[model samples]
Target: MNEYKIEDLLFEELILMDQEASDYEDLITQIGELAFEKGYVDKEFSKAVIEREKLYPTGLPTNKVKVAIPHAMVRDNVKKSAIIISKLKKPVLFKEMGSSTDSFIPVDIVFLLAVNGSKDQLTILQKLVGMFSDDDAMVKLNDMKTASDTIGVLKEILSQ
Candidate 1:
């Protein structure tokens, strides 16, 4: 596996307050704005995010934990990027990607992913999946309350 730097693999701009009125559109706008501020995406990044969300819902079914993986296509707006993990106090409902059923997935942890390429993106996602799969890592991640704390945990995990 290709090793990534802590700064390169994680986005700190994920720290935000999303209200109950905030839908997927609002979430995408917030993430897109952060991506733009970080110079990882263009001004039109929100459009790409919405398009990607429409096609592939990034809601993962977590039996043991509460997490969501929200990603988008990298062709238009993304340059260099990482996963922006946000811990929400309340669960948000998202439709499952490629599924027709009315099943809505409730998620507390959101991983807003911005990638430069399709193949490279999957690799990053796999790394995160592996990291989160570790019982110890999940515990450490969930225990974190602040952005700095979360970033510290992510840095430690990536370094390992």
Candidate 2:
């Protein structure tokens, strides 16, 4: 579990404060390109994520804020263990996680996870779920005005 620090996996460069996307696929593509260009993920990362979302949606409908945690298997695709946090300009529809079908939600935030392996992914997902369940934390994230502010809030919540 000590393979990587939660705070260390966050990069200021990957904090997308105001992202605009027509749909979830577009959002993932934009974020994926950023990560790929930064050498964090491979070229096929975005496509893989989209496919995975179709089968196992990551859309999480939290109490205060709707969010999504999208990711693909590492499988040598991730060059670095970094999370790309994107605050969309507007909410986008996503199939809710654990839904059989016909269940969707408008997501305000996107957490594009580019981690090392299954172990790290599960650990980060647990931490993220805890953060999402916190009303105060989700509200704070929603109100963040800058990328650095987002990082600060995430570091504080994720560290706990």
Candidate 3:
């Protein structure tokens, strides 16, 4: 398996707003626009993001370290890629994948995955899951309050 480095995949282009929005719709819209502005997405990318979220929820369950992975097809957008990390002040409700019930996940970390396709996206996802699966790494990420701090922690994890 290819070891995906979150830092290499992330940069200032991936850092977005840190405040919480009223709802998922607004949150997704704001993040999608930022992705587009950074050349990671296209004009219609917002619609795709919403549609993808409706089909496959990206929220992951955790007690201390909550996160969400929102992603869509690159064909619907551009060839360039990015992974945005946002720290929200409040929790958001997202549907669980393969299930009808929704989960009120207190997601302080949001990883907006922008990839080319299933293969590359899956690779990135695997690395992300593997890296964050460690309780220590998750704690470090949760404690991070700034984009630079978060990126630094991710880089350290990638180096290991």
Which candidate number has the best lDDT? 2
Cα deviation at 81, candidate 2, in Å, is 0.9
Off by over 4 Å in 3: 1-5
Error of 1 at 117 (Å): 2.5
Q: What lDDT would candidate 1 get against the real structure?
A: 0.70
User: After best superposition, candidate 3 residue 96: deviation in angstroms?
Assistant: 2.4
TM-score of each: 0.82, 0.97, 0.87
Poorly placed runs, candidate 2 (over 4 Å): none
Q: Which residue pairs in candidate 2 collide?
A: none
Assess candidate 1 and give its TM-score to the true structure.
0.82
Off by over 4 Å in 1: 1-7, 17-21
Given candidate 2, what's the lDDT at residue 66?
95
What is the C-alpha lDDT profile of model 2 across 121-160, one tens digit per residue?
A: 8998898898899999999989998999999988888888
TM value for model 2? 0.97
For each candidate in the order shown, give its overall lDDT on alpha carbons: 0.70, 0.90, 0.73
lDDT (tens digit, per residue) of candidate 1 on 15-100: 54332426666766777787788787788877877787778887767655556677766556777766666676667777765578
